[model samples]
Target chain A: MGEKKFAIIGCQHNHIEIFIEQMYQLGYSCAGIFEEHDRTLAAVIAEKYEIPLVENKLSLLGETIEIVGCASMNHEKIDVIELCEQYGKSIMVDKPAVVNQDGLARLEVIIERNRIKVGMLLTERFHPAIYTLKQYINQGKLGELVHIGMRKPHKLNASSRPAWFFNKEQCGGILIDLLIHDYDLLRWFTGKEIKSSAGLVGKSVLPEHPTFYNTVNVQVELDDGLLTQLYADWHTPSKSWTWGDGRIFVTGTKGFAELRLSGDPLLGSSTPIMLYASEEEEWSKVDLIQPHATITADFLSFIKGEASLLTHEELIKASRAVLDADAAVLYKLIPSSKESEPHV
Target chain B: MGEKKFAIIGCQHNHIEIFIEQMYQLGYSCAGIFEEHDRTLAAVIAEKYEIPLVENKLSLLGETIEIVGCASMNHEKIDVIELCEQYGKSIMVDKPAVVNQDGLARLEVIIERNRIKVGMLLTERFHPAIYTLKQYINQGKLGELVHIGMRKPHKLNASSRPAWFFNKEQCGGILIDLLIHDYDLLRWFTGKEIKSSAGLVGKSVLPEHPTFYNTVNVQVELDDGLLTQLYADWHTPSKSWTWGDGRIFVTGTKGFAELRLSGDPLLGSSTPIMLYASEEEEWSKVDLIQPHATITADFLSFIKGEASLLTHEELIKASRAVLDADAAVLYKLIPSSKESEPHV
Candidate 1:
């Protein structure tokens, strides 16, 4: 419990580095790394970070690792999770892990059977603005929350993305891959489940890449009548330095707050949080208080058979709801004749 | 057509002055004014603008007036339009004139019989951004039109609103008086009719005002694959000078554009139009080319039996769609248990 070793199963998502860096800063030791097949990509990551590379999954699992963080290719995430669960190791996986219904059902079984930690690496959980927002709402600084508008845009380095990245069947479109973060964030911020939702999805930007849904938009109605509109796209033009220029606008009864995540890398910097009450003429930007240390500390406790920062139930439900949100997008769109033809 | 005289038939909405001022600047004569009941308000406006006040509706229509501008209360618009038509006068009226189905049906006949110049004074039509956008799209500078996201926030002078403003039956909630403007704007921008729409309306901000829908959010799907999201609220905090901090975001195949309608009067100014294309690394804020002169000139020409600036059919249809968009908000929301109880 004092200081546990954290190992990784695969290295596909860039978020893996965030987890590793955070854990390292929180005084955790690195054990070893394992990749299913792409040893070249694995070797590149291992050498870059100077971590030991293992021969096989068993070798990494058998090391001093008490917890395994898996950033496997989307299609292979479920299997990698199953392998880690069977070894009785607590696991942390990237977002949109089990996209399809079949994978979702398997995830439920693994979660219910084991007490080992299972967390989706929603790095936004470690973001300072989110914590600030929760504190504001909890203290009634902002009156009754009415609307949460989220924009989550990621820079899709098409060339760097693995073969599975373009497959809608595996990644569940732009809604799942990029937008799902907000779906979870809204729930955690509001403490209310989504009651109803409807939306639109388009692969508008990348006509040559017909299969990739580069843009997605959805409207979600919370159980308590809170209206939320979310737009996520892989529309970050190469000029931007950040991976995602995320944003959230929360409208409450007495006030409004807007969060510009990653400081609109397009602007070279985004204010982490900004708020304005009814009497205020200008928006006040709030300083971000990093939750990474606390988040990593919690994961370390979970690895030591203690309580997790976020409950397994909450994490599982968040993942499930995000996948369900994809259904809303699918049904809302009627196949346009243009879908068959390339966009002009 | 040679400097035709314009007359007013009500002085309820402040936009009536916007119409009068625009026409006057274009060399049209302000013949006279008439108000059904709010004569004190009408007389004050008449004296301030140095225009004479007529004895009645007939007196105003009997002048050198070739076209009548109506800014009657929401409930009285139909009567004013009917009265103007009987006198064989073409009319320009304030937005959301029709508050119900019967009003819409009656409006169709007024348009079908004669030109009657029944144009809804949608001034965003005159805003430099709309014209710049139209030029961009028409010149094929931006590729196929896709989505328009509109944020229209109107200042709620809660204490000053008339008795009818509180009644949805008369004013049609925030969706009717305010949100309807975008519904019309989107149609004009896309030149495509709406195929389907779904949304949520809430009395979220003003709890004391039970029946008033102070907040409304909607998603509209165009016949072709265009998507539009509109958020309207009477919740613009009292700190700003502009009555509405309105904005429109236009997304296209080759480029993207964002328009700030009134500029956040709080910031004291706004970028009227900004565009970014695939090759352009930074967003370019375009200089606004004022269309008010052109729009007013076109309306003046229409009075002489020439083509209308906006066709009657298109204008009426856009108005009808805006009313119907309200239906999407109606059905999407289930009455919350807390709706009956007073909110804090």
Candidate 2:
């Protein structure tokens, strides 16, 4: 194969940095860059990665680059991805590729008409602990899977964010932006399609940002009677050592595991994976298992006409699930009276 | 106050041990004991605490015992509590004081007719970490509270459990039996009544116990918009050092705190209360704060005609909330189809 090359058409979010670094590790060099709105982020990334900035997006899309990695604004992502699809290039982009149902519908049609791979920066799928958990599940270490609990709390860093970050119309709700990763992992870990999903949003801490919601909680059930809950917020306190304190809990009939992905607070920043199996005497910490290939590696392989670990259809399904969850957000006043009303 | 005295009327669950120990610490001697169902547990407690076991329950309830502590089978608790109320005696009991709505309604009427205090052994309320957290909230150290997450995982220990433990009708299902603590704590910490609560239950492990559910997830919204999620399961592996690995996460507008109550797996079983405030540099551990009074102390004060820390209304309210939550269990098939139907 000739030199594997990818071009960056957008750099609105810092996740583009992860996409670039992972691609570099897999011998896929950045061919060019283009960013119209967030030139500062684009410039910083260009200087750091030593990539030249293209004057226009088409200049990079028209080049011989086999992949386009876009981390544009949430609402604008579908536009860039559709453009890349029309250019006959596989795409890798940050989460909430489309902000709302309309954008998702448009992207679906674009994917149907175009024949190129699309991947998301759902980085948790490749976390060392999650990778090992997947192996254990496949090996039946955790017998019949029961429930999963995930928490992703990120520091808002409001002053550092662009204006568009606070606009719900442009950024999508917290459900789609923060919970999309959760929906993806629930499917990946269970290998079962989502049966139903629902979410509730609140602007507990960010009232000044009227259009923004700082907290979100989601509950999802899988096809085969497995349940999962996700809690995400933009309210991680400033004193938190990490940008986000992320963790995942996996339960099974034979055993259970808790992956402290980051911000252990007391136990250093190590991703401690604690396991308690039926035959063990006490809960023990499992060694971290780092996988050889990353998500970018699989995307690179897909663009190279090889089998993919994550397929385009799965990406769309997960995205659709979150968007639908966002749509079904309940604004009803939760009754405090003496009645048991079913509300999600 | 004239040598505070209490008697044990039921010992179906081991929690009676806590009830006895705490009452003794508050200078209340165990006047008598009565247990017909679990003679083994009753005999063990009798030998350990050096209290005599009475052949009939009324012998103790009819005595000058100012308080009756009951830990009977789930469905039989109301009968014991009602008898104690008829004798004009205050009572403290294990959780799920009543199995369902009807039981809650009956207990409500009994409490109205008899001017007696009733408290459930929602022990987490008095945990050093939780006590400290409550102090922080009262001190405005954690700004306006945003969200709370709690996990309670207990080793099923099926072999050691009574047969009634697995019967949903008898045990009140996992929602009421396990999540009652969560409901109580949610009210105690927020100091706000619950607006709505819902739960999903699954029998992930014990198929033989068809009437039992081993896993439960609950979501509650406070009247003021504070949100909380609770997860409880009976699948804690034998390797777990503690009966349950319980933890609580408290999020606020100014900061957040995570209380590792037990079974840290890596960290020793110290109840590490980690705090991350806006002004701090990093997450730091706070020294445990032991409260001067236990829950039983408060119950003793209530029985002695002194002001009660936990009002009878609050205990009944928390129980009613969980019972109502259990009634609204969604057996709806979570749709795996494209549409996102709202399912709690």
Candidate 3:
């Protein structure tokens, strides 16, 4: 196999650093980098990872460079995506890919015109616990999946964040930012699109971030009759053991499964996936290979002519569904009342 | 104090028997029982508990019977409350106290005119873990309470449940029948009235229970800024460890507290309250007295002219708040979108 060269554009988001490291681990290193307006992030990447920085986006788009990894601010993602498509390089970008319908529509044209593949890394899926969770679901060990509970609490280091990070116009809201992970996984795990949803939003914790909702609780119904709840927060206190406090509880017909994506908050340490099947009397942990590296390997294989995990159409559908769900909650849309109301 | 006398009316609900049993353990015994129809329930109470069945509601209202415990189909509960009020007897009834505004208005008139004491047992509160959880909150071990999560899954032995139990007009749906407990405790724990709420409901698991949602997820905001989520269902399969798979996760400024009310699903047995405090690196179990018996004792004291855990007005306010929240979910009320929605 030829060396799969890759370049980074917009290194401001944290996920970009992880993507570069994962790619490097799979016998590929950053071939070059470019950040048009500011080189601060580009300089950091160059100095820290010893990767070279190019003068512009054009200088880095090489012939053998099979993929370009983009991590611009959510509202700013379409530009990077278009630039990557212009060079005919397949793209692996951070989530939401684009924030609203306009950006999504524009990106859609770029992908179709260039016939380029655009993938979202969604590293949460690569957590060992989550990888094993999917394996169990496919094995039918968890039975008919019914409910999924998610809590993704990311620490907000106010002093370290860029001004745009706190602005909704630039970053999208909390749901589009953090919960897009849950939305993507919800469909993949349940094998259904969201049929309906409702959300409760609060700004109780961090008043300083006026554009951010520090806490959000959203409940969604999947087409396959699955009910799911996602709780996302940017207020996992400054002193917590991990940068994020994350948990996923999947309840189904045959039994229940849980994953502590970060460490076990109560135990003050990280743990693996735990499964309790219908017949089992105790929780048993599932074992797996290092998840991130495996995900990287899988991505490379997909780039190397293997069948894609997500169909091109499925990717766009998932993106649009996620945005609609976000709007349903953010717009506080009143769902048409169910005819058979539960109340007397 | 002299022996406290009690009476039971409308044996349709199972919780009535539990409340009576707990009261008996506290030196209070049922002076009489009454069931206008369905001798089956009355027969069980007479033969097993050996409490005598009365001819009518008035017959049970004796001089020494300072309190009356009423458990009827929710729609039939208001008449029982009025009967108790007519006799000037204090009332202990199942929730929701009323299913609609008309019932609530009628009950309000009786409560005001008779100035009667009406308390709900909310026995889930008696769960040992929950008792310990409240203790932690009161002690400020879990500081500045922020969120409470409830999962109440009632096992649906479909063939065993009465017809009225499946009727929304009678049982007040899943939220009223099940989530009412969480709502009552939410106020007591957070010390706030509900400010707003949103609910997502489904009838996915049990198609037969068409009138009932069977599954509900409601999120509420308290006046004090506490955010709470309640998940209630009557579709718990027969093989589950307990009739209810209940859990409460309370997160606060200082730490997080959790309770497994019915039992720990993973361990296949009951669990103690678990608390993870900020200063502590590990979770510790919180000790508490037998919760139900303690609650029973408190009800007895409040009936005997002692200080109340809640004022008479506060009790009514809590009941009304629970019903309103249920209706808010049932009617699918649209909340005005906040200028800044929580996301990312």
Best by lDDT: 2
DockQ of each: 0.35, 0.47, 0.15
Q: What lDDT is reached at residue A199 by model 2?
A: 53
Score each candidate by Cα lDDT: 0.70, 0.78, 0.69
lDDT of 2 by residue, B1-67 (tens): 4676789988888888888988778777888889878688888889999999989887887556878
Tell me what fraction of the real C-alpha contacts between chains A and B each candidate also makes.
Answer: 0.21, 0.58, 0.04
Ranking by TM-score: 2, 1, 3
User: Model 1 TM-score?
Assistant: 0.90
Please give, for residues A1-344, the per-residue lDDT of candidate 1 as tens digits. 55668898987766787778777787677777788766667777788778899877787776477778888876678888888887788888877677767888888898788756677776677678877777777777556776677777666778887766777775666777776577778788888887766776775555455567766778887887767788876655554445655667776666666676765322335556554545354444555556635665666666577766566666677677767877656422223644332121
Task: Quote the TM-score that chain A achieves in each candidate.
Answer: 0.89, 0.91, 0.88
Query: Higher-lDDT candidate among 2 and 3?
Result: 2
Q: Which order, best to worst by lDDT?
A: 2, 1, 3
Tens digits of lDDT, candidate 3, B1-344: 48778888778777787778777787787888888766677777777888887787778887888788877878888888888887788888866778767788887887677577777766656667776777778889766665677777666777777887777778777777777677778877877767777765555445464565556777786775446678876545555566765777776656665566764544334555454535453344455556434555666667677875544565577667767876666422112121211111
Answer with 1 or 2, whichever has the higher TM-score: 2
Q: Judged by DockQ cut-offs, is candidate 2 incorrect, acceptable, medium or high?
A: acceptable
User: Which sequence of candidate numbers ranks them by DockQ, best first?
Assistant: 2, 1, 3
